[model samples]
Target chain A: MKARVTVSLKPGVLDPQGRAILHALEGLGFSGVTDVRVGKLIELELAEGTPLETVEEMGRRLLANTVIENFRVEPA
Target chain B: MKSGVVVFPGSNCDRDLMVALELVTGTRPVALWHAEAEVPAGLDLIALPGGFSHGDYLRSGAIAARAPVMRAVADHAGRGGLVLGICNGFQVLTEAGLLPGALMRNAGLDFICRDVALEVVTTDSAFTRGYRPGETITVPVAHHDGNFQADAETLDRLEQQGQVAFRYAGEVNGSARRIAGILNDRRNVLGLMPHPERCVEEAHGNLDGRRLFAGLVSVLA
Candidate 1:
């Protein structure tokens, strides 16, 4: 089994990298680009029948910092 | 004071911290590897030197925080042993849950490396007792993710408790309340993003950073 963790800065936490990307898009004449938020996708290859709770535990423990970021686990 | 500097694979400032400790305390600090499950007994202080631990992967200090040795460090802190984490070490402490808040990317989206002015917020901890409150000192801060962020309530609690040790005199990083250093609730653990060890010697251009080590020795030794 494989799992994917999507980690993103929580709303209201400033994202400077994302803001820089947004400015770059505007500079390139890309209109209607209201916002850009950068995040990370971590793919894990786990043994079959690995519990979803275990993956969530991984997120809570290491995959994301709950203080400033949130993570969602996706099964593939 | 007897001290130890935890050395992770990517920790580049371990030697500097050891040197600073030796110079101030007049005793060599033990170099504890991150894989070790237990810190040596009878250590008065455990210093986490600044560096790109675990290559800053996943998140800053995220991997190193879960390292085997951190359990021992936490136990040490739990026993009221002093802990000082500088720069990357600060990030590690927060990730380890020994301290509060998180270090985020600098608002400018650039790696800042230079001497910045910092105001000592409180002289209440073993770490900052050498300086008077409101004293401005120059220290070098070299980091990309030095911006500090926390929820409103935590910030207020820190202020009310005098947990904030140092604050940037000017806008150096986009840290909440311009916090440069903060002490744990017990006041024995301090995590700060500036390189105090780097400025401990006169050859380093100024001795402003030396007082932190000197103060620790006075209190803990």
Candidate 2:
């Protein structure tokens, strides 16, 4: 089994990289782009019996920093 | 005072920190590898030097924070041992949950490397006791993700508790309230983006950074 973790900066946290990308997109003639927030996708391969709790623990411990980012796990 | 310096792979400043510690404490600190699960006994201070730990994989300091030695550093901190984290070390501290807030990419989207002016916001903590409150000093900072961010509530709590130890005198990075350094709630741990160990000698252009280590040694001794 494989799990994909999507880690995103929390709301109200400034995403400078996202902002820069948004600016670049606007400069390239793309409009109506209100905002852009960048995040990370971490793919994990685990044994079939791996529990969701164990995956969540991995997120808490190393996959995501709860201080500035939140993460959600999905079966891939 | 017995001190230890945690050396993770790619830690370029470990020797600098060791030299500074030896200069002030008159004893070379033990170089503890990142794989070590324990810090040596009878340590008064543990210094986390700056470098691109784990090549800034995932995020700056994210991987290194989960290294085995950090657990020992956290435990030592819990025992009231003083911990000083500089530059990348600061990021590791935040990632390790030993400090609040996280260092984000600089708002300008550029890597800043230079001497930055900082004001001592709180002289009460062991890390800032050598300087007077409101005094401005220059320290060298070299980081791409030095912009510090946290929730409004945590920022307010840091302010209310006087855990904010240093604030930038000028806009160097888009840090909240221009925070350059901060102390843990217990006041024993300090994390800052500037490299104090880089300026601990007269040959280093300025000696303003020396007082920080001097103060630590004085207080701990």
Candidate 3:
């Protein structure tokens, strides 16, 4: 089994990289793009039937900085 | 002062910080590797030097924060011992939950590297005791992720408590309130983006950063 963690800057936290990407899209003539938020996707190989709590713990401890980022785990 | 400098695998400034510590304290600091589960005993200060620690893989300082040595670092701070985290060290401190807020990518999407003016926000902490409040000094910063952000209420508390130790004389990284440095609520731990260790000698064209080391050494040693 594998666990995939999606980490993103918490809402209302400034995402400058996302904003820059958005600006580049607009410059490239992409229209109607209201927003862009950049984040990370981390995949981990875990034993089959591993509990979500364990992966969540990874996010809480390392994968995401809870102060300004949020992370969610999904089965991969 | 009996100081120690934590050397993470990718830490490049450990030598610089160690040199500054030795020059100011008249003794070399212990070079504790990140793998060590314990810091040297009887250390007055533990300096986390700047670098691309753990290669800034998951996030700046993320992996390094979880290294075994940080367990010792956290213990040191909880005992009221002084800890100074510079640049990537700041990121590690925040990631380790020893400090509030996070340093994000630069707002302009550029790697900023240059001298910038900073104002001392408070002189009460062990880290800023050498400077008068509101005095400005120049220090060089080289980083990609130095933008500091936190919720509004946390910012208010830090300000009210004078935990904000330094702020940019002018905007440099789009940091909230232009914060260049901050002290932990205990006022013993400090984290900042600027490389004070780089500018600690007159040969570096400035003695402003020297005062910080000198003051801490005298008081804490």
Candidate 4:
């Protein structure tokens, strides 16, 4: 089994990398970009029958820092 | 006071910290590896030095924070033993749950490395007791992920409880409330972005950083 975890900064937390990308896009003549945020995608290989709860636990423990980031786990 | 400095594989400041600890405390510090499950007994201080630990993979300090040695460090911190994490060490402390909040990328997206001015916000912690509260001094900060952030209520509580030990004298990194160093709620663990070891000697330019180490040894001894 494979699970993917997407970690993102909590709303209202500053994302300088995302903001820089927005500015760079504007510099490239793009328009109407309301906002930009950057995040991480983690791929995990789990044993068969592993529950989403287990992957979510991994996210809570080491994959995402709950203080400033939120994570969602998707199964494959 | 007997001190031990943890050496993660990628840590480059362990020797600097060991030297500073020896100079200030007049006792050689034990160098503990990241894989060690327990810190040496009778250790008064456990030092986490700076560098891109575990190559800053996944997230800054995320990998090294889960190292086997951290379990023992956590136990020590739980027992009221002093733990000091500097720069990258600060990131590890937050990731390891020894401290609150997170150090995000610098607001300017630049790897800032220099001697930045800092104000001693509170002298209540074991680490900052050598300095007078509100005094201004300069220390070296070399990090891209030193921009500290936390929820508003936590920030307020840190302020109200005197956990904020140091604040940038000027806007160096866009930290919340311009915090440069903070003490854990237990007041035994301290995480800060400055390198007090780099300037403990006169050759490093100023003695401003020496007092921090000296003060800790004095108070803990």
Cα lDDT tens digits for candidate 4, B1-221: 99999999899999999999999999999999999897789889999999999899888999999999999999999899999999999999999999999999999989999999999999887788899989999999999999999999999999999999999999988999999999988899999999999999889989999999989878877
**Candidate 3 stretches greater than 4 Å from native:** none
In candidate 3, position B87 carries an lDDT of: 98
lDDT (tens digit, per residue) of candidate 2 on B25-74: 78889999999997789999998999999999988999999899998999
In model 4, where do residues sit more than 4 Å from their true spots?
none
Mark the regions of model 1 whose C-alpha exceeds 4 Å error after superposition: none
The candidate, 1 or 3, that scores higher on TM-score is: 1
Name the candidate that leads on DockQ: 1
lDDT of 2 at B190: 97
DockQ of 1: 0.96
Arrange candidates by DockQ, descending.
1, 4, 3, 2
lDDT head-to-head 1 vs 2, winner: 1
**What's the TM-score of chain B for every model shown?**
0.99, 0.98, 0.98, 0.98
Question: Docking quality tier of candidate 2?
Answer: high
Docking class of 1: high
List model 1 lDDT by residue over A7-26, tens digit each: 99999988889989999999
Note the DockQ of each predicted structure: 0.96, 0.88, 0.92, 0.94
Residue-pair clashes per candidate, as listed? 0, 0, 0, 0
lDDT of 1 by residue, B64-164 (tens): 99999999999999999999999989999999999999999999978999999999999998999999889999999999999999999999999999999
Q: Comparing candidate 1 with candidate 4, which one achieves the higher TM-score? A: 1
